[model samples]
Target: MAHSPLDPASSLPTGPAPRVSVIVCYLNGANFIEEAIGSVLAQDCSDWELVLVNDGSSDESPAIAARHAANDPRIRTLSHPDGRNHGVAAARKLGVDAARGRHIVFLDHDDVLRPWALSRMTGILEREADVAMVFARTLYWAWDMTIGKEEMESSFAPFPPGRLAGQVMLRDLIRWDTRHPPPCSIALRRDVLLATRGDGALWHGMYEETALLMKILARHDVWLLDEVVSSYRMHPDSMCIKAEAAGTLSNETVSRDRVRYIGWAARHVAMDWRSRLLALTVWLKGEAKLRLAPRR
Candidate 1:
């Protein structure tokens, strides 16, 4: 049989593989798969892989991925065991398991990367020598797929390597105002993920990014790339919107998730005495407030 245009053998050139692997944890992501895949494929840096983890999507996500993967060896697709929605944490680890690159970037099913994302992020990592994780700013994308403005994310704000990172992190722990773009805009040496054990329990009821951020903070020097490297699409079907719409467990989950992150900062992040004391007070007050709130 002659080769079809859909085959990876026909469309992708097999040569030097990428040093970075982007993990995409997807659920019912059929509509956005192409844009998500295309963003990484268009990266300025050529040495990267796109690991697409299909966590038992109900729609045509798998079929969509199949068509795309057929023509690109760089796109690796893995299915959830027994076709279950194994959550983002598990899906991400599975993506990591399949990754061959030394560096990793993660994207949501609906997010897209700017072409320079990897090239610029890793530029810092390679030069900084001691840094283990890095993240950049994100360009917002509205539901209609139009470009939005650039936004800066929060990290353990400007500090040279040492205990100061933990201090600033602890001070802002309860505020929940510090912005790190979700996993899509973050990149790390593969070692950070390996060290964290990739557990979903880390996130508790909220999503995975916060847990991973706190966990990563424990061991790595995270840097801000300051470039808008990806687009986070805002849509009606977004989990937070639906939760707010239903007015039920979603509220409780978000609350619990917030505490989990604050708790992580309190417990693991090393800080100055004043910062620690403040964190302790904040933790107690927040815990009390949440414990008293009636669950729906």
Candidate 2:
């Protein structure tokens, strides 16, 4: 049988694979690319490979990534041909296709991983066979709020630390008990990710990570580490911020798309009709709140 591009068992180069593949996807993020790549290099666990995907960046991002790649044998770079910019999801797929690790984690060019992140999460995955995904808390460091101010005053974890630790099932995640951690904070078994691959175009403009998370959650329970493993930078040019500024993403659009995502998840994850109905009800109530909300 011919192997699919998404298949982990496909004919990849034969060699010693890394324990973890840290994929940092970026475009025109020259200012923060160094810091993002630096965080991975500074990891406590050194048995990892850094895959830097340059999605047709016009800035010094490609140059910086190349410099780092030249200096470190563990770093490899990939880019979209012809210098045409592909969106985030396509960039991610490129990295995933070239990954050579047992476990995989996605990092953005603007985020920074804590020094202990790799060792801690990989440790948990190694120790627990049942846990398909392990995610940790993130500290949202707002750039506008942090500039010229004391570092201590700038960042915060929106969710209380230690509140949602331990193994959580798919149903629990769907309940919306807490915010879903960003892609940077979560690590997954590579095989599991490949098997649940969806049409990358579906997530081109929005909800990329959410779609992937829902699929992973469907088949296996995830572990939540109480510690903050990464820092998510929130700046004016960030994707969500840009969408909001352009009026392309509104409360109504978000709610409606979420309901659509829930239905998609229910169908693909093989959920029973009862669970699907329950998910529908949850979103309906959420939609009601948006309707009742006062206009700004």
Candidate 3:
């Protein structure tokens, strides 16, 4: 289906521009898509738009997304020309291109945003002129009642809650010295996101967010929040879990992806001598980790 941008004159409710555009790209996510959409609907901040990109779902998720869009004008659904599965990164790019908000928030189909997520993050962005983005802690949720409490907990980054230089954060992320911000927990300026696009058309496989974040950090500073703003559901069907089950989560695969990420960084992110040195260090560390890790 042909996807069109949200027309302010017709598609949106009469008001100021949406403060945030929440993008949820799903592929056969019928089971959890509703809860995800509901979380966005439940957001205390009403000044937001929801774009549900149907990434070639074979199940009833398209219908679910359509139903939600029918009930709420703030929600719109989009897909590729032939409704093909173009991977998460491409679907996200499509959503970003069509988003009509000042800021962007990426919510996975299986994840839920807390009610205060948009308000809290957007508030920081508005007040901090130098900050290009803001991210907070995320709850790793074991929503299945059968699961134990140990599996359900909060994840906090090592960074303090305040504005931080992008280069420093980027280096830490590459070196695996800190917990990177999950996509669900981040809200970034739309303009900054567009500007941060690297040489790649779409980051293939995993580490897509890493590529995007590295680009952003190379150019701007970001704000860190101490509060938990989203819940990331831990389930068997998650990408990492599935990869592990399929034997594709091997160190070899991860090392290859990491190498690709480092190469992308070299071209698009680490321009200065110091940054390049950090990239080299990260590469050496990755090689050592790969060599030390046991084969699947």
lDDT, each prediction: 0.67, 0.72, 0.79
Q: Which stretch of 10 consecutive residues in model 2 shows the poorest summed lDDT?
A: 147-156
For model 2, how does the per-residue alpha-carbon lDDT over 161-209 read when each residue is reduced to its tens digit? Answer: 3223222344554565335778888898888888778423233345567
Error of 2 at 226 (Å): 1.1
Q: In what order do the candidates fall by TM-score, top score first?
A: 3, 2, 1
**Clashing residue pairs, backbone N/CA/C < 3 A, model 3:** none
Instruction: Give candidate 1 misplaced runs (Cα > 4 Å).
Output: 1-17, 144-174, 198-201, 246-256, 268-276, 291-296
Estimate the overall C-alpha local distance difference test score of candidate 3.
0.79
RMSD of 3: 3.7
Candidate 3, residue 106: lDDT: 96
Q: Model 2: number of clashes? A: 0
Give the range of the ten consecutive residues with the poorest summed lDDT in model 1: 4-13
Error of 1 at 191 (Å): 0.9
What C-alpha lDDT, on a 0 to 100 scale, does residue 168 get in candidate 3? 81
